[model samples]
Target: MSKSLLQQLREMTVVVADTGDIEAIEKAKPQDATTNPSLITTAAQMPQYQSIVDGVLLDAHKQLGDSATDKDVANLAFKHLAIEFGKKILAVIPGRVSTEVDARLSYDTEGTIKMAHDIIGLYEGAGISRKRILIKIASTWEGIRAAEQLEKEGIHCNLTLLFGLHQAIACAEAGVTLISPFVGRILDWYKKDTGKDYKGADDPGVQSVTKIYNYFKKFGYKTVVMGASFRNTGEITELAGCDLLTISPQLLGELDSTQGDLPRKLDPEKAKSLEIEKLTIDKATFDKMHEADRMAHDKLKEGIEGFSKALESLEQLLAKRLAELESRESKLVSAD
Candidate 1:
């Protein structure tokens, strides 16, 4: 019997589950679990998580009482809901959980920092240590600045939606705990741009991550790189020795079922030997390079907007659920 690809990959890399599905995470049993607004919204819709969703909304409503409007309850519920899911995920995974701050605050440095403090505080109030939580933020300049401050305060961060080397360098310089450079989305852009089939190392997404990984290792940056948003097992396989890879459960299943000789693709020692230039990568350099890289620029903006919409949808769901709960309580009182 051959060792599954997932088993082989795990030997060289730390596997993290990028999902909100508890059962999936349980089976995959990745070192860490990550949740974004999109994943959380999808999870909230499931019948099994009804109690979890209701519990969060109802508790927020109860705390606020009649003074809080539906929007207020929904807003409060939205904030606590992410933490509640994080707590549940923390229960099952021993490593950590990446719960994102509100995407609307992505470009707001002050707001981002405050939310990071609030998020970490919530986790701590629940008795979950700050060490076990990674407050995920977008990889915007403002977001990176916020992360830098948070890191000094012992709040770890995962700079997400990262695309170009500019973002990676900025994150490394910021002393961020981790970065989630999107792989699949980059592939999507290149495929549409060139209409050419790319596989293995030729994949633009894989290439981007390889570049960033090598840059980080070569320059001796403390920040760890985690390749994220993979489109297939091939992309995942191509970056085998990454510090971490947050894979979707569907892809994790593919890796688990397939048998193969998975080789280490990225190595720190190998990276150190490779000659790569280090950029100053301040705000001006970051903006210039970001503007030059069409793929990164487009993807970063699209990602933020998409997550923002997911958040909006979640608040709407919470509002509706809150109304349902309120109506039920009203009916019970009338009957009494």
Candidate 2:
């Protein structure tokens, strides 16, 4: 029997699951798993995870006491809930798990660093090693700086929501453990901008990741490039030799079912022969480059807003659930 595309890809690239669904992760058996606010929100809605949500809310209420405001409860609950989900996910995947900080802290370097520490501490308190977790932060300059500091302290970081070469280069300089350069989102932007249907290697998203992969390999940057947010299996196959690829369960299944001739599209040796220039980007240059690349600048802002909105939605969900729990407790007390 011929090997499926997914199997073929795995032989060359490390497959990571970009989901919070435990069942899905188990079924796919990915080496690692990544969770963002949106994925966490989706997971919280499932009946199986209701206990995890309720447990964190109860803990938050007890810790904050009766004087706590809804905001306090929600914020603390979110932190606990994210860690709880991460712990559960760690049990299934043999490798590390990527748990993100709040997107609103994307531009706050100090806040991001502190949150990274708090999250890692939580993991450590739970008997999970810090080495098994990747503190996922946005690819903003501030976030990259935070990752640089954290990376020095033996905490690995995953720079996410990355779009362009500038972001990739900055992350490489920061020595991030990994970078999730979004492939699907870039394609979406180009498609809407140009109104052209792109496919396979012609896809703007595929081309973007390929460029980053080649650049990284060319310069001998140790930072891992994990192409993320894939729109189709074609994009995945196009960058088969990436350091890692965090794929959605849907795309993983698609690749698993399809038998095909998967070829290596990226080669480090080829990158070395391309005669690429080494460029340095300070704060001023970084800002200028961002201003020049309208697509990356606009998309980075959109991605941050989307994640922030999802986090806000998660807060609201926790508030509602906490109220329901309080109401049930009040009813029991009245009966007593």
Candidate 3:
């Protein structure tokens, strides 16, 4: 009997779980796990995650004494939450966790770089080595530049919201550790505009990732390519041989249940056989490509906005909690 489709793909690609749900990740057994601000916010709302949040608050109280500012408490709380998740996830997977920097700092090069270091510091404080974390950032030119500097300091980066070859080339030039080309977001733009559905090799999103993957493989760039934000099983199956794919658990479970024949779709040999010529871009060339690709440019901005809003919501939640605690503390002091 032939091996399962998922089993076959496992040989060619590294499957990563794209989520903050630790239990789901444990069940899926993906080699790596990735979390963004939105995913983190989602996880915090779950009843199972209450203990993690409580632990963070308890630690913050112990460390800050009687005068912890709301912002300080929030930052410490988020850090603790990230590390707690990282710790749990590390036990189930053998690979790193892609923890994102604050989305609001996406355009601020120095701030993004500093926050990246701070995130690493929190992880190290938890006794987790730097090797097990990939500091995730938006794939803006600024973010890419920040990642470049961070990589030299022995910190790995996962460049997210990437939709164009310009972003990919910039990331590669910056010597980023990895780039996450969003497959579904690209498809979303096309689908919404044209009212057309794409499948098989005809998928624009799949093709975009394929182009980037092939380019990286052809040039022997050390930066890993991870296809992310997938829309369906077809998109995932089409890019089966990508270096890594951060898949949602729903699609993963779908793949797990299905028993179809899955072939190696993204072989380096096949990429080499393609007619794509070697290409490199300077700042001017990169700008021109960005100008030419409307979908990439629009989606990149939209993704950043969505993430920023989610981060703002998280901040508000933290602020409300802090205020309530402060009020309760004042009442207790009066009673005493």
For each of the candidates, the C-alpha root-mean-square deviation to the true structure, in angstroms, is: 0.8, 0.9, 2.1
By the lDDT metric, which is better: model 2 or model 3? 2
Name the candidate, 1 or 3, with the larger lDDT value.
1
Give stretches of model 3 more than 4 Å off.
69-72, 323-336
Q: After superposition, how far is residue 188 of candidate 3 from its true place, in Å?
A: 0.5
lDDT of 1 at 50: 90
lDDT-based ranking: 1, 2, 3
How well is each residue in 270-329 modelled by candidate 3, as lDDT tens digits? 776667676676778777888899998899889999998987777677667767777888
lDDT of 2 by residue, 1-336 (tens): 999999999999999999989999999999999999999999998999999999999999999999998678988999888899999999999999999989999999999999999999999999999999999999999999999999999999999999989999999988888999999999999999999999998999999998998888888999989999988898999999888999999999999999979999888889888878897877887888888999899999999999999999999999999889889999999999
Candidate 3 residue 304 Cα shift, in angstroms, is 0.8
Candidate 1, residues 157-276, lDDT tens digits: the string is: 999999999999999999999999999999999999999879999999999999999999998999999999999999999999999999999999999999979888999999999978
Off by over 4 Å in 2: none
TM-scores, each model vs. reference: 0.99, 0.98, 0.93
| Window of ten residues with lowest summed lDDT in model 2 | 274-283
Off by over 4 Å in 1: none
